[model samples]
Target: MARNKNRTEVKNYKKKKLTVSTSEESPAKKKKMSPKDPEDPDDALSKVESPEMKDLEDLTPEEQRKRERKLKKERKKEEKRLKRESAIDDDDEEEKPSKPSVCELSLQYLKSWSEKRKDWKFQKTRQIWLLQNMYDQEKISDDYFPILLEYLEGLKGSARDTTVKQAEDLMKEYDKSEAKAEADVQKMSRIREVLQLLS
Candidate 1:
């Protein structure tokens, strides 16, 4: 059997493996080393300030520290103001919804109908909304109350009955309270005015 020369491993007697010991430092290694003082006043690294505060370098050390502190406080205050403004904007967006309420839609429809009654078709939902919200001054303003009452002239079925029922009830309340309090007298008279107009 022939021995393959490629399979045989050759060891060089001249070559040697080098191992570094932790105790020795290599001459090839060069590094800058310095001692850190915890209380050194002239320490550049310890006295480093923000880029914006670099302009204050010409001031006295005490003045520089004070200016830096003042600048930091002003920066934080401005940030807080911006945050508050953004929060208020978000709140406003949340409070004021994009879509109008049923009352608004009802009022819009009523106004359109009032302007062009022949062109504008009647909507049951708007009629019902007007009937429901007519009593509340907050929901239906005094300016539009008369118009809503006029619109109610064409109301029929249970809706018309309900309005009469509510109007009679309001009248009773008004007459009873007339001697005691005259606060809602104007409110009751609004319904009465409509009844008079209808009659």
Candidate 2:
């Protein structure tokens, strides 16, 4: 049997590994390393006024308010974006045309129907009122309420009083709801009482 040269093992002449012990650094290696001072005013200031420092004193009053407003708006937009993204078509639920609440749907129906029955100027006026109503949701101004009330009063001869009364009552209810909401908020807050007194 021939011994294969490729399979032959070489003699290992390597020294066995040893764990050498180390002592304190030599004078050459121990070049002067300074210790930090306990009471440097500049260092103290630098620590306090670092890039990540929460120094409201450095920021302008307007800048502070603007940052807060921006943060609030971003939070609101994120909430709205999440709500819109999560909208699901629930098939099991009744498919009766889903609307933006009864109040909003009624306002839209009235606006469109009134536009068709009446004219452009009236539609424009109604649209402005509708926009304000959507924003406020709680308050109906005296200007709009009286205009609507008068219109309803005049329509008594043409349309049923019951129908006109319902529209009039909706406006009245909106005003009453706003008043109640204000009262409720006042009752809930001691801060509001202080602010009211200051004003």
Query: CA shift at 43, candidate 1, in angstroms?
Result: 37
User: Which stretch of 10 consecutive residues in model 1 shows the poorest summed lDDT?
Assistant: 9-18
lDDT of 1 by residue, 1-199 (tens): 2355322311111111012121142222101011236466544443453222243454557655655565456456656988999999999878665798888899899899789888898788888788776767778888898788778777778877777877777778777763643436556667686566444
Candidate 1's C-alpha runs over 4 A off are: 1-97, 178-183
Each model's Cα RMSD: 19.3, 25.2
- TM-scores for candidates 1 onward, in order: 0.46, 0.20
Clashing pairs in 2: none
Q: Lowest-lDDT window of 10 residues in candidate 2? A: 12-21
C-alpha displacement of 87 in model 2, angstroms? Answer: 16
Tens-digit lDDT string for candidate 2 (72-116): 464566558667666543444547677676445545545445455
Write down the lDDT of every candidate, Cα atoms only.
0.61, 0.39
